[model samples]
Target: MMKNNQPEVWLRGALPDIPKLLQPAAHALLQSKEEVFKYTEDFPEALLWEKPAGRASVGFHLQHITGVLDRMLTYAEEKPLSKKQFEYLRNEGVENPEVKMDDLTHAFSEKVDEALKIFKNTPEAILTEQRGVGRKQLPSSVIGLYFHAAEHSQRHIGQMLVTISVLKP
Candidate 1:
């Protein structure tokens, strides 16, 4: 049972109890994509499904989510991607109508799966090794990387939900 008085696990500089943490948010994130992709007889091609005119479009936001997680995982492994790679992933999806929404989701999830496997096999002492994530001096542990990966996923899922609502409005 979660105790109310326990410091919120996310804020603390501690690894979350993963067996309890990883799957639910991951599942929610994967499931929530249905908002963009939808589950109906008449769901349209992702390229043609427009969100509200003023906001970040559905594909762009989804790419941003995937890009962030992919870059973060790469950082965790000490093989951070180049800024160009980051920009390409972050911006490319929406700009091109040819990109398959299912492909994007599947590829992003595949990266997440690799990161999860890394978490399961990586020793705690090693994950705690400090590595700079960009120009910032702030340090992140392996556990923190794991936490960031999952949380980032949920955050974007929420963004997708809003986009879906706006599109339907």
Candidate 2:
């Protein structure tokens, strides 16, 4: 249950200085961050890579949450993905025993911080500006990218939570 009986982020009124057009995106992203941390607290490192019933591992969700935000935000800025970003994307789901749960969650939290900073600076006027996605150059706007980032992160968060619940023994 939400503390103080507060409603969802969108129901809480306007976020200071956030563009009106991007408010829902910001709310969703913030909500995703809160739930990701909540569900992953005390999650065991040993189960980080476990796939329950063929579902994606917790580690994959963690990495992808951070990476997608980075990639989408890059696109939202009308920039192409860097070689480094592509490299990170390639390695997202690969098992790394050296990676701890806290490390992945911390990285995700840092990405959320970066995203919030971007949201604060984004001009409402540029929300509809066109941007290309990936090498195919699929068209999308700044708002589309940000909204997708928010929804995509929440989708992964749901999957991760289920995996965590099933793996926690």
Candidate 3:
């Protein structure tokens, strides 16, 4: 919960200069960031890669929350995925015993910070500008990409929370 005790981000109202249309996205992203930290604060590194019920692992969710935001934001900027990004995508769920839970959660937090910076700089004038996604070049608007980034992170965070609950004693 926010300091004000509000549950939902939208209840916080408009941010200083964020575009009205983009405020919800920013709020959602912030909310997801909060939830990620809350759920993973004491999560065990040993179970980070465990997949109960064949669901995606907590580690995968952590990596993906960061990766998807980066890739989708790149696409929103009308750019193609870099070679490094493709490599990261290919390695999403691979277990790394050395990776601490703090590191994974921190990476996700940093990515959200980066996304917010980009979101603030995005001019409302370009929200409707067309952008291409993936190798197939499917069409999407700037707003569409940004909104998806927020929602997608939330989705994965929800999954991660469930996995954490199941794995934690």
Candidate 4:
């Protein structure tokens, strides 16, 4: 929940231009963005990479939610992952002394904005178009990919929240 105790994004009303079927996905993504900012505001840069009990670092989740959503949206567009995308995936949880929490959070928020734009432009008729995921090209529809992106982001946010609480002292 938000620190201000505001209603969740869905209750805020339909986002302009997003298809009815895609509304839930948009809402979830927006909510994730809000929570990420809320929880990470003023968080210590030093703790960003900490992984208490072997859990993923908050930084990993921040990077991951953005990366995964970008990849999934590319799949939704029926495209293959680029070499750069694969490289990013391989480096997701690695320690990086140069990384900053603000940078990670900004990337995630920007990705969510990109997602909203995609949802707005997507014709409802095309939401069901068949798409492939990863090298295996696993079967999924456009809407399926979008939904997965939304849900996957939320799942990581929850995991990140747990790590944040545990490490916050």
Candidate 5:
């Protein structure tokens, strides 16, 4: 069992103590929304979800990113989810093959904004008890969860950007 103070210690292990670097990750996550719209409806030819070695289609890639956010942020909030919903959207978020970019982008942006707004508005004291994946039994902090969610999106968005380049090239 982890001691009460151990959660912060664990979080610091995966993420460095420097909160300054996190701002860029947050910016990248926000920029991903604009980039999604820019590449899809406005400019389909722009590389947004192209993958090398013949991976998921562009549409699926976009949906995959959204699905991840939905799980890491939405599900983490303890919303009721059907078994199928948990199985497909949260579990196999990346394996699907037929998501339209416009729809995925819109939904993703909404959820991302929702979670970010919560993090921005939530009180410091109340935020500590919020649960995150794998930390349910341990009672994780909301600030850590919020940052993890952003970092999670930012990392995958970076991958999507690269995949787009490969497909475009």
Candidate 6:
């Protein structure tokens, strides 16, 4: 159960081993992870892919949060997406009978952990260095990519919560 009394991750003070410049991004990602689990804790698997009012399903939000983080982190490292990464992106909203809310939420949680490890190891100096995003190679910096990933995760979490509420009995 989530403890409502404690402050959000950003207010919990600086995380150890993360660079000062990257702390907010890390905090945001951590908060997103917490919110994802909290909102989906009692969500029924039967409604995981339900799209109430034609909004994106909760399952897609969960998967996209995880997959986008992976892709963004890869770009931050100045790398291209692998074949498997592209495959994941293509299937983001497609539902499978095997997928459950727990599995999707847990994947997002794990992706956040992976992101933290990258943030810890990132050199502060290179944060502002330019990097490219997507096939068009739109310009962005390391910090930009990381911050986008964090903010994007938070956005999807909010959408997922609304979808879950609409679908819940």
Q: Residue 51 CA error for candidate 3 (Å)?
A: 0.7
Give model 6's TM-score versus the native structure.
0.97
Please, what are the lDDT tens digits per residue for candidate 2 over residues 92-157? 988999998888888988898888889899988899999999999899999999999999999999
Q: What's the residue-level lDDT of 163 in candidate 1?
A: 66
Q: List, residue by residue over 1-169, the lDDT tens digit for candidate 1.
A: 1124534334344344434445443444444333334421132455334656666665666677667776777777777578787677656545676676676666666666666565556665675577657546368865566667666766776676676555642
Query: Which candidate number would show the highest lDDT if scored against the true structure?
Result: 4
Clashing pairs in 2: none
120 in model 4: Cα distance from truth in Å? Answer: 0.4
Q: Write the per-residue lDDT of candidate 4 for residues 1-169, one digit (tens) a residue.
A: 2467668999999988899999999999999999999898777889999999998999999999999999999999888999999998998988898888988899999999999999999999999889989899999999999999999999999999999999986
Off by over 4 Å in 1: 1-42, 46-53, 90-93
Number of colliding residue pairs in each model: 0, 0, 0, 0, 1, 0
Task: Extract clashing residue pairs from model 5.
Answer: 50-163
Model 4 scores a TM of 0.97
RMSD of each: 7.6, 1.8, 2.0, 1.3, 10.9, 1.0
How high is the CA lDDT of each candidate model?
0.57, 0.88, 0.87, 0.93, 0.55, 0.92
Candidate 5 residue lDDT tens string, 1-169: 1123432222334322324434443454566665666445443533434445876556555666666666655545655455665676553335333544556778878976765555555555654566645425445555555666666666666666556555653
Clashing pairs in 3: none
TM-score winner between 3 and 6, please give it.
Answer: 6
Ranking by lDDT: 4, 6, 2, 3, 1, 5
TM-score of each: 0.67, 0.93, 0.93, 0.97, 0.61, 0.97
Residue by residue across 1-169, what tens digits does model 3's lDDT show?
2243565776877777678888988898888888887787767778989999999999999899899999989999888899999999998989989887888888888988888888878999999999999999899999999999999998998988888889998
Model 4 gets an lDDT of 0.93
Error of 1 at 102 (Å): 1.8
Supply the TM-score for candidate 2: 0.93
lDDT minimum window of 10 residues, candidate 2 = 1-10
